[model samples]
Target: MRGFLASSIGVTCAAALALPLTLPSSGARAVTPATQSPAQRSAESVPGSTQSLPLISFGSDRSQGGGASREQGLHQREVKPFSLVGVIWDNPDDELNGSVQVRTRASGTGTWTAWQPVETHNHEHAADPDAEERASGRIRGSTAPLWVGDSDGVEIRVRGEAAEQRSDPALHRGEAAQHSGDAVEHRASAGSPAAAGQALPAGLRLELVDPGAEPPPQGSRPKGAPEALTAETAAASAVNADLAPLGADAIPPLSKKKTESDLIAARGGPEEAAGKARPYVGPRPRIITRKGWGANEKLREKKFAYTRTVKAAFVHHSASGNNYRCSQAGSVLRSIYRYHVKSSGWRDFGYNFAVDKCGNIYEGRAGGVAKPVLGAHTLGFNTNSTGIAVLGSFGYSNPPAAAVNAIARLTAWKLGLYGANPRGSTYLRSGGGNLYTKGKNVRLHVISGHRDGFATECPGIRLYKKLGKARSTSARLQGR
Candidate 1:
C-alpha cells in the first residue's frame, strides 16, 4: 500500500506529478489509443515497466540508546540488464534503535559499490521509553534509476525486525505474471517469502503463499511413518470424543425474517417505524436548514465565486501540529489562502472548505451548494469539483477522530444536496478528458485526495486508503 504524506504547496505540486490521478466512474469514458499523444503514452507506460529496476536494501541497528545507531550490511541484487538505483525505508516506530544504509553494484560484478547513507534518525521513539512499545514514524527516502532495461531484474533486502510486540505476524503476499509483446515472459512477487529464491524464467506463473509457514509441496507430500503422528492422532480422537455430546447442527442458522423486536430496534422506536411505514405525514420538504441569522451570515461571508462548481472533491492537509483549536483553524485557513493567492497566484483559497484538527468545518474558497463554484485546488478538475482542506499536516501525526468525523459529515451533506449516489461509481482516474462529461443527473460525488484529478499527497496515504469507507459512511448517513 502506498502512503501519502501531507506536504507544503511546492512539494504538493511536485509530488502530484509523481502520483497517479483517480477519476470518478460516472464520468469515465475510454479514449482510443490512437488519440493518445506521445507524452500520454510515455506517462502511461512508465509506471508499468519500472517495477523490475534494481532495489537497494539497507540495514539498521537500533539496539543503542540515545546516540544514533550504526548502519551496515548494505546489499544489492545482481541480475541481467539491471543496476541498483537507491533504497528508502522508515523506522516509524523508532523503537528499533536502528539505522538504514544502501549500496549498489552492477550485475555480475564481484566488487561491491561504495555505501550511500540515505537517512538516520535518533529521536524517532521519543514518545515512548519502552523499547518493546510500538512507535509510529515513516521513511520517504527513494533512490534514483528506479528502472532497468527491458529485461532487467532487481532485488530488495530488508534488515532489522520491527519491535516484537508491534510486528505484523500475518504475511500477506501476492504475485503476478506477465507476457511481453514479443512473447517474452516475466514474474513478480510482493511480500511473498518464496520471492527471494524462486525466480521464474521466461514464463507466467503467479502464486500466493504464507510467509510464516513452509511452502506448499510442489507436487505432493511424501509418505511418512504412522508412528510419527501417533500423539497427534490421539489428540484428535480425544477432541472428537469431547465434541460428540453436542448434536449435529450445533449452531443455529441465521434468521432471515425480521421480528417485531428487530423492527423496533431498526426503526429506533414504534413512532418512527410507523411514520416510515405509513407515509403522508404532512409536507416534508427536500431540504433541511437551521433557522438562525448568525448561521446564515457565516455561510454568506464564507462564500466566493468560481468559474463553475466542481463535480468532485479534492482532499488535502495543512501538515501542522495536531493541537489545533477552532479559532486557530480560521487562522490556518487564512494562511493557506494567502499562500495560494499571493504566492501561487491563485484566485482566493484553492479549497472550498477546511476541516480542523478538532474536526470543525470552516468555510474555505467560499462558494457552496446554492451557487456551486470551482476552485484551483485541482488543475483540470477545478471546474467540476469541490476542494476540502484538512487542517494540520499528516506527515508526522495522525488525524484526530473529530477531524475524520467532521469530514464524513460534510461529505454526506454535499453528496445529498447534489443528488449523487455512492454506489455504481468507480474512483479511478484514467483516460483523457474529465470523467463527469458523460453522466447525467450526477450532482455530487466523493473521491480521494489523488482522485480529485491531481497528484501529490493531499490526504496522506493512511487517509487515502479509507476513502472508500468514508464515502460509504457518508452515503448511509444521507440515506442514499
Candidate 2:
C-alpha cells in the first residue's frame, strides 16, 4: 500500500495506461454469445486509463488528539489529453465532509473549463451502501468520476466543512450518542463524520482517466505469430467483438404493442374491454445482465428494498465526457459502480438501468430490472421512477440514435409490465427537492428527463430533447 504521503509523483505515461482493462463491443455494443478466453477478452478491455494523485491535507484539528483532518489538493500536472477524472479520500470513516471538484486545461494551450463537481453522494447508487466490501483496505472513498472531455493540464482541490467538529467536547458528545438507535440510524444514513461537523475532507486522491487509442484490429493470427497466441484468444476475440463500437442499427427495436386505450376502443369501449384481457407484446427486452457487464455482486452488502411499480423513466447523461469506446463500456460501468458506493455514499447505482452509446442496455441497482427500484437520480422522484443514464455527456454532442431507441425499448418493456403508458403522465409524491419539495405530488411524463423533476441540468440538453421521441417509440413498441 502507498503511504499517506503528500507529494507529487511523476509517472511514465505507458505505465499509467497498463492496468488490467476492458470495454465490450458488439452489434450496437450488444454481446452475441460465443466461446472465448477470459484473458483475451481482458486484454482488449479496460476503461478510463487512470493515474492516482495524492492530496495535501488542510485545516487544523480542533477537537481531539490531532484535531479534525484538513482538506487536500493536487499540484497542477501535465498529462495526456483526456476527458474523465475522479477524487478519492484515504479515510472511509466519517472524517470528510464537503465535496470534491476539479478543473482542467487543454494540453496545447486551450483554456480551462470551469471547475466541475464530482458527485459525492453516490452511496445510494451502489447495490449495497454500507457493504463491508467498501471498506476494503485496497480501496478508499471516492467521488463520482466526471467526464471533462479532452484536457491535458489538470488541478484538483478537495475542501470540506469542518465547523461542527471543531472541539473535542462537542465531538465527544457525538461519539457518546453513537449507541442510541436514533444515532445508529443517523450513522447508517449519513456515515460521513466529516458532514456531521461541517468540516472539509483530508488525505485525498485524484484519478485521471484517458480512454486511450483504439485497440489493434483483430484478425486471424499471423502464421509466424508468437507461441503465446492461441486458439482461445481467437474465441475470446469473437465473444468480445460485439462490444466493439456499432451503428444504431445493431440494436433492433421490439415490435410495437397496441395502446391500452386503443385496445379498449378496439374492443368497442370500456363495456367490451371489461370482459377482455390485454395482450402481452412479448417478453421483456434482453437486458445485459450484471454478469454480462462483469459487476462484482460480492462488493455489495445484501439488503433489498422496493417501491410498488415504476411510473416514470427519467433520462440522464453520464457527463463523463464521450471519451470511451463502446468496447470499454464494462470498465466504465465498474468505475461508476465502485465510485458510487465507496465515494458518494449511496445505496447502489442511482439508475435502474443504463444505456451505452452503442445502444446496449445493462441492468442496474441490483433489484430486478422490471421492479420499481427506487433510485437517487432525480432527488424528489426516485421512488416511483426509474433513472436511465446514457453513458456519455450529451449537452452539446448529439446522442446516438441507438441509445435513444434503447431507452424506448427498455421503458416500453419494463413499463408495459406495470401497464404504464409511455406517452402518458404519472404523479410521483415528492420526497423532497427543488422541483417538487417534500410531500408535493409531482406529475411528470412517463419518459421524462432528469431536469424535469430536479434543478440539475442532468440528462443534458441534447439528450433531454430526445426523451419525447423515446416516449413515442416506446409507446409504439408496446403496440400503442
Which one is best on lDDT? 2
Cα lDDT tens digits, model 2, 1-480, are 011000111211121121111221123243222323343234333333456667766555566335655556775778776656787666544444565778799667768877776655332222222223333443455555786656798887776655553332222222221211222111222445565654454556677766444333333357754222123223222222322321111222223332343333333555536746664333345566554565544444344345555677888887666767887786677667655654445556667788999999987765445345555566556676688989987867999999999998888877775668889887877665433446766667888776666545566678877877998888887778
Q: Pairing residues by index, what is the TM-score of model 2? A: 0.56
Candidate 1, residues 1-480, lDDT tens digits: the string is 001111111121211122211111121232322333453233111001112222222322334333222322323444444222223222222122222333444445455544433222212101112111111122221211121112222323333323332222111101010111111121111222111211111111111111111112222335641111122112211111211111111111111122222223323556745645421111111111111000111111122333322245656664333444564444334333433332222334456666777666654543222224444444334444566767655644667777676666666555333344443242322212122221212222354453233223445555555566766766555555
Give candidate 1 regions above 4 Å deviation. Answer: 1-310, 320-323, 423-445
lDDT, model 2, position 379: 57
Clashes of 2: 59
The true-structure Cα RMSD of candidate 1 reads 27.2
